[model samples]
Target chain A: MMEERKTKDFPRSDSASGSSDQVVRTIGLSKSFGEVRAVADLDLSIPRGCVYGLIGPNGSGKTSTIRILNGLIRANAGRAWLLGEEVPVHVNICRIGYMPQEMAIYAELTVLENLELFAGMYSLNKESLAQRADALLDMIDLTERSDSLVSTLSGGMKHRVSLACALVHDPELVFLDEPTVGVDPELRMGFWDHFSDLKRAGKTIVLTTHYMDEAVRCDRVGMMRLGRMIAEDTPRGLMESTGETHLEDVFLHKAREGSA
Target chain B: MNLVRAYAIALKTLRSLKHDRRTAGFLVLMPLFMIAIFGYTFGGDIKDVDVVVVDLDAGSANGSVAALIREDLAGRDVLRIGTSEDRDEGMNAVKDGEAWAAIIFAPEFTVRVEEAIEASRTGSSAAPATVEVHIDASNPNIAQAVVAELQTAVQAVLVGYYGANPAITVSEDRIYGEDAEFIDFFAPGVMGLAAMMITFMLSIISFVRERSTGTLDRLLATPATEGEIVGGYALAFGLVALVQSAVILAAAMLLFQVSIAGNALLVLLTIFLLGIGSQGLGFLLSSIAKNEFQAVQFTPLILFPSILLAGVFWPLEAVPDLLRPVSDFIPLTYAVDACRSVMIRGWDAGEIWPQLVVLAGFAAGTLLLSAYSLKKRG
Candidate 1:
């Protein structure tokens, strides 16, 4: 469905949104909590059919930026756009998917029940819900344990269930916060393969993670520190510009340069 | 505002309870246990109160005034009358807490009553008879019961002598509750209170869980609006309040034999309104809390005032003059009033519309406030 829209020559969006190709865009986006600034004047853009990785330490503003764009919280002093509409737009929120850092699924419900719940919120009728849920469950490899209560599942399995729930609606733009935090190496590879599949299908993914090694797999990596994007480019460009062979060394060099 | 969205949220909440046996048990049985405790403490007749009677009547043996009154007391089920020759011994029994009260007849009590009756007939002054009652008022309930029993006996004995006292006669014509008990008064109040506590506590805690667990943020990112979420919670908790009411009413009627004079469904309707309003209030207050621990703190803040001032534990009349105005503002006061009017006084909805209107106002107002609070920005 998303591939069809990408192939079609749609008209340019309003001037505020640069073009229909930028699935996610932000300008001077800032947010604060009391005296601490979470996201300070951060400018970012993620194009269609691209896997974007937002790499930052614990106190950096990766999650805050995603929250503002998702309309979960409004930006303090900036504007954003998602899917060619000015953000915090109530009407167009269904086209985006969000998987928060916390285990947000209901612990008392079954794995299948969690996916169906998010599907219902998007107003998917019964027939579509069953079809979408079955496919998602198969992808997540929880088809057999769909009826088991989530509270009884293993930690890695629970994370997989959260991901399945996020993708049940097949959102055109997806935001995943630390999506592979607790997964085993084998499952992580399986998840990366799924993301590659989604990108080929013309879906945009914006994910935040501290795993420096994973940034190599993303099409573009945004190096963030103190609510500011220090460096953003293709992995090879970042490695070459910073004279660092490893992606982890590239981040350390950029972070130290920004601090100095 | 959308029915499908609202119903969907309600279904998810109810479905979560199906596997959680402990929480479900707390939801249904907590109110039942509380009602049992309150009913046991407040309802019932004071039975088998020991009383000593010292009769010193020096006139008429068979048709004596003292014997008539004593026989009247002994026949009733409330008291067990024991004979005593010395008034001091009877007084000592009451003082020692062995007996609830002492009934003493003064010497020549029958002669004095008869003389008093003649004096009244002839329009002359005559000495009054003294039927002295010495009671231990330690337990006020037992004391009141003993006094009421004695008054009935004395009145029955005196009725023949004076023939109903034509000039000072005032008959009580009850328009309602010809056979009301203390349980009858308490059942409706308990139902309202149980409903309020359950609905109020559940919504606050449940909402806080949603926020702390990050589920609320996930939902907010979707197509679901804050109003739809709040409406869904109201639907679910409102249904819970209804089920709690049914269980309470059934228990009250089956165990305590509390009969409803008017419609039972109207009584449930009143509690439902009150419960929905409380649920909204809970949701509104939940904004200040950061977690379930803080959310639990609000229960006492809301429960104590409603229980004390809402006429659940006692009537509004018993409330202090200063606090009566405060009582007027509590939604539970109107609920208890409406429930009592329906269960005991046989009042229909038309007669209790004012209370219903007040409750409905609470429901609408608090729900609006909750939805507004949920939306930091529209």
Candidate 2:
């Protein structure tokens, strides 16, 4: 579906061999939970190296969209393409790391062990997994607590470990669903800094968060409501279009107007 | 091809097990406890079976059979001997639950025995010693024991007086079990029960935990297919079942003198397959249970049917014919039958192929069902 939606520049073989032009593409993606349309007839074309924010309210299909994109559940009527390949049931899901709303790290394992396990799940070599684990522990400022069990870690620490796990294999694209829930402000800033650093390294990121302020850092934001994208533009472009001073008020206005 | 990933998943599982000490204990110690409890308790011989004897013979010379009976019953602590002058008292003793059986000897038993011995030399059909034992027919084991004790006492007295060749020959044959102690036969069923308990309960609780903790959703988001996840668990628990079966078999052999007449390897293989079947069953059950407590509550539903109808404790043949068909439906019945035949009868794979086929069928069917359950859209 992403292949079909490539109206923009497609990275040539000479420019970026084996590298994708579009990291994620979805065409007319529709997912229904019973009679409720969780994600209906949506199309998205995400570039290979931009931080895309999917901002939506509770039960606004942000989770459902991420779940579908991650291949956790099949779409009732749609197709998805990841790095130019169709998202079949047996797609290369390992290539795209996903951090869910619920902290996905195993609490029973030590932080290091959790990193090793996640890295290994991506089929990382032993030495590479160890090195990556150490680097991630250092990057997340969790090296001192590497040996501590995850269950003993505070919520913010656990969230950091979860993010580290998603990045363990150094995937080109990452999907983070409500990654900032229960996190303190300082840790949340540190997390956003890491996300920006990841994007600077040419890794595509698609994250969902209800916190509208955090969304200002994303290259672009798609405000979704009731399974439909009501507004899609850069935060500055949206602010300019709506003449709204705050992104939160823009979302509130759109929500009030029953537009998004 | 992602062997590393699968191994990582397994390692994570083991790591989690370290934190959940109760589940770890259940996985490792529960089998040992089952073996210890069942191995020790069931291996004990049937004891304290109340018996009331109504001996009507009146003379010392003729009462030698009674003396022989009292002598033969000397060391068997199971037989609680009670005497009655009248047959009604002994019969009443059995009816009133005071005794398991009532042994009624006729007034002319000794006299008739002697006469029959004399007449048997002339090739008469009359019995030399007709000891009529009216047992409480409620428990077949007690009835069997009562008849067997009477036959043994008669044969012993006859052998003491006239050697193996008595004046009149008595032929003994079993009605239900040809020649089996309860322990000898029940061991295989115990194996199935042990496997079922270890595999089913643990997986049910573990999977429920996975669902509740949202680990399953996370895992599902990864490249791991539901089949692979379930398959990975099957491998882990399969190994557990193997070790458990070996321990139980060794214990059975050591403590109960249980002979495994079949190949121990084949028996283990059967148990492993049964383990997979049970794991699938656990998964299928896990979908219905919302929590670990509910999972435990549902465990006995599976346990009761297998215990009562699976021929684990008793032969299906011993069950009423009307209820016998239900035994055939229980998966453990086949395992118990196969295990017992192999362990006790020294049956080969060829002899036990039907059981293997059935177990394979169960594992395959349950596994498919379990896989389908994971793919449930609703």
Candidate 3:
């Protein structure tokens, strides 16, 4: 079954392929913690240079899917690919950046130090790292607080630091889990602007959030419920198809249909 | 493994510690504090015990037994002799805790001692001269010191009286650790214990924090392998342990005058290896703990057993025979043995290779296990 999925997913590596534009592809990707299936038989494909928001409530297997894609955890069944390379493989790890929902930045370290540490992990040279760190700090509007320890930062500032650390290596693919959960509306607008800039610069972004407003900004959104994708469409398309005015109503409509 | 990546992890960890002033203070000052507490208070020798003596023996025509005891014990400073009017008074002193022990010499002590010596020559049994020792026994060390001092003084007097007869005299020879004291034996073990404890505790708490705070998940997503992560931690903690050991050894030497007879570098190397092994053990143990509070629960589990079985405060020979084999399995045991051999016996690498090899094996095995544990993510 694994071989079948592998061959079906990748046929002739050098040839122009159906998945050529897709940065992330997964089929029948399943994961379980104890008896509860956090993610079950998830089939997802994310195209390059597109912002794909995984919209779901809490406990909807969004974090699990991201973790599996980033090789932090393994799928119980099926396989995944990142940047045309098989995930759970070490070769393309440097090409991918992940920002976890929790505050993953080292609390004891300053914001600049956290950025430098992540940049160094990717073997970035001193000149490039310093330049990139400054740009990222400015982008996050945290240039003044870069020298302060992350623990002293407010929750939203620390979230910005985590996002900056994820992007410090300038990876082609970035996975952000709930990047704007506690962010202020103004900062969330800034994050969306920065993400749009990243998308325009040809970086593929996959993010998970429950906010309908954030979901509306994505090029496409996958609405997840109970370890499965109930619907996948553009924000306007989803509202239109469900005959609803808002993404929240559309999500409720799809969830009712799924349970039915 | 990528050396640069591993070094990056090490640098990040060190940077984090730089900001964590409390942990940094613990790392630098804890060893000094431990040395001061253990070296000056808990590890000092029992000395200058007071003993009340009611020497009722008047004389034996040649000398007085009480005078001889006073002469031997008074000058040596091992025992402080206090005179009592009678056995009741001497016993009262011991009972009142004024003295550690009371030596009540029989009135016929000298006569009976001489008679016993003469009777031994004639191959006949005689009544033995008795010295009844009434001890407080509250502090066993002081009580034991009193008894040991009395025996030594008595033996010296009898041996002098007999003029070193070949038939019943014991000769002395010098070997390793000539005139070694308790502090000398204790210092090296303290070094090993300090290194093991600090390295283990820091790695465990640090790793647990990494996991709980999601830094480990972020790191795992990077290009860094689990081996590189563990290696990075081991390197940083090993260096810290080296510094800690140095502080402890210097303090032990300067404050307690603990001697180091062998290559000091070799002793330090053993301690460093123990640190590496302990860090690996910490990593392995951290995998079982979900949070820092659970990690703290592991302290006494690792500490008390190592202290009791690793021969830190005492020799392995002093442990019960049934429990002797258990000591060999503890990593700190090999460290303590190697360190003590180097610092006390002046043993070089050739004589201490087995211990070094075992320690190396322990480090390698635990490090591999730690890496495996880290890689075994759900």
Per-model CA lDDT versus the true structure = 0.80, 0.76, 0.81
- Candidate 2 regions exceeding 4 Å error are A1-20, A89-91, B1-180, B375-378
lDDT of 2 by residue, B67-157 (tens): 5666677556657688899988887776554676777666766666676666766676565566666554433465566677667777777
* A200 Cα displacement, candidate 3 (Å): 1.7
The DockQ values of the predictions, listed in order, are 0.42, 0.32, 0.59
**In order, how many clashes per candidate?**
0, 4, 0
lDDT of each residue in B1-378, candidate 1, tens digit only: 899999999999998777665456657766775575345434534556788888988766435788888888888768878879998898877654467678888778877777777788899877667777777543344556777887787787778555733211112222345566678777888899999999999988888888888898899888988788888888889889999999999999999998888999999899889888989988887887766756776676577667766767555434554556777888999999889878876779888899999999999899889877767741
Q: How would you order the candidates by TM-score, starting with the best?
A: 3, 1, 2
Task: Kindly list the interface RMSD, in angstroms, of each predicted candidate in the order they appear.
Answer: 2.2, 1.9, 0.9
Stretches of candidate 1 exceeding 4 Å from the true structure: A1-19, B1-170
Top candidate when judged by DockQ against the true structure: 3
Among all windows of 10 consecutive residues in model 1 chain A, the one with the lowest summed lDDT is A1-10
- Candidate 3, residues A124-215, lDDT tens digits: the string is 99999999999999999999999999999998898889999999989889999999998999889989998999998999999999998779
Candidate that beats the other on lDDT, 1 or 3, i.e. the better one: 3
**Candidate with more favorable, higher DockQ: 2 or 3:** 3
| Best prediction by lDDT | 3
**What is candidate 3's DockQ?**
0.59
Candidate 3: global Cα-lDDT? 0.81
Q: For every model shown, what is its TM-score relative to the native structure?
A: 0.74, 0.72, 0.75
